[model samples]
Target: MSKIEKLLKKLCNPAYKQNVRKEELESILNHFFEGQWTFGEISGSHNYRIYHPYFKNFPEKFGPEGFLTIPVSGGKFIKHFYIKILCRFINEIKEIEK
Candidate 1:
C-alpha cells in the first residue's frame, strides 16, 4: 500500500469504530483531505480532487456521491474501503456540528 493510503486507513479506522470527539475528527478530516489538498505528495494528504471530480472516471468507478455505499471491485480495494470510511467520518462530523 502507498503511504497516503496507509495514513488514510489509519485515520478512518479510528473514526469508524471508536468514539472520537467531534473536534478531533473535524481536524483530522480537514487536515488530511482539505488542508493538505494533494494526492500522493504529502504524507497524510489525499487529493481533495477525489471528492470533487471534474471528470467522470472517479465518480463512475466509485460512484458520484463521494462515498462508497457499496464495495469497489478492483485492485487497491482496501484504500477505497478506507475512503468510504473517511467520507462517512466526515459526514458524521458535519452532523455532530449541526
Candidate 2:
C-alpha cells in the first residue's frame, strides 16, 4: 500500500475521530508548512498551486468538480500540492462545520 493509503486509513480510524482543537489543527498545518513534517504527496522541495475550478458551465462534462491543481515547480512532486490542498480543504470544511 502507498503512504497515502496508509495515511487515509489511519485518519479514518475511529480512534482519531474526535474534535480537533484549533491549536492542534494549526500546529499540524504549521508543522507541515515549516518543513518539519512529511507525509504522502507533500514535501519540502516544491512549490504548489491549487485551483478550485468552476465546472458549473459544463455540469455534464464534470460533475461536482470542486478542486483542480497543477505544479509549477518541482517536477514529479505532486505530494506537495496534495498536502497543501488536503490541509486547506480539511481546515475549510472544519470551519464550516463549526
Candidate 3:
C-alpha cells in the first residue's frame, strides 16, 4: 500500500472508530497539509471546488453532510472536523493517483 493510504489507515484506525475528536482531527489535518500549499493543490481544482460549497443541498457528494455525521457540536467544530476529513480523503485519493 502507498504511504498516504497507510497514514490514513493509521489515522482512521478502528481503535478510534467513529468517535474521532476535534483534537485528533486537527492533528490529522496538520499532518495532511504539512507540505501541501493549498486545498486545491491537495484535492485538485475540480474536487477542491466541489468539496467547498456554500449551499448545503447542492448535492450529496459535494458536501460533508453525507460522509460525516458526528452529532452536531457547534459550527466551529463541525467546520474544522469536516475540513480535516476532506483533507484526509483527498490525501487518500492522491495516494491512489500515485
- Residue 81 displacement (Å), model 2: 1.4
Q: Give the TM-scores of the predictions, in the order they appear.
A: 0.29, 0.26, 0.34
19-76, model 3: which lDDT tens digit per residue?
3445544454455445332223443231222222222443464455422233324422
Query: What does candidate 2's lDDT look like per residue over 1-98, in tens digits?
Result: 75544554444454554433333333444433344223335665333322233323344543455323333323342333344445545455457558
Question: Candidate 2: where is the Cα deviation over 4 Å?
Answer: 1-62, 65-78
Name the top TM-score candidate: 3
Global CA lDDT computed for model 1: 0.43
For 1-98, candidate 1 gives per-residue lDDT tens digits of 76544554565663454333334433454654574222334454333333433222456555665432322223122233445555565555557558
**Model 2, poorest ten-residue lDDT window?**
47-56
lDDT (Cα, 0-100) at 92 in candidate 3: 60
Q: Is candidate 2 or candidate 3 better by TM-score?
A: 3
Candidate 1 ranges with C-alpha deviation above 4 Å: 1-17, 35-62, 65-84, 87-98
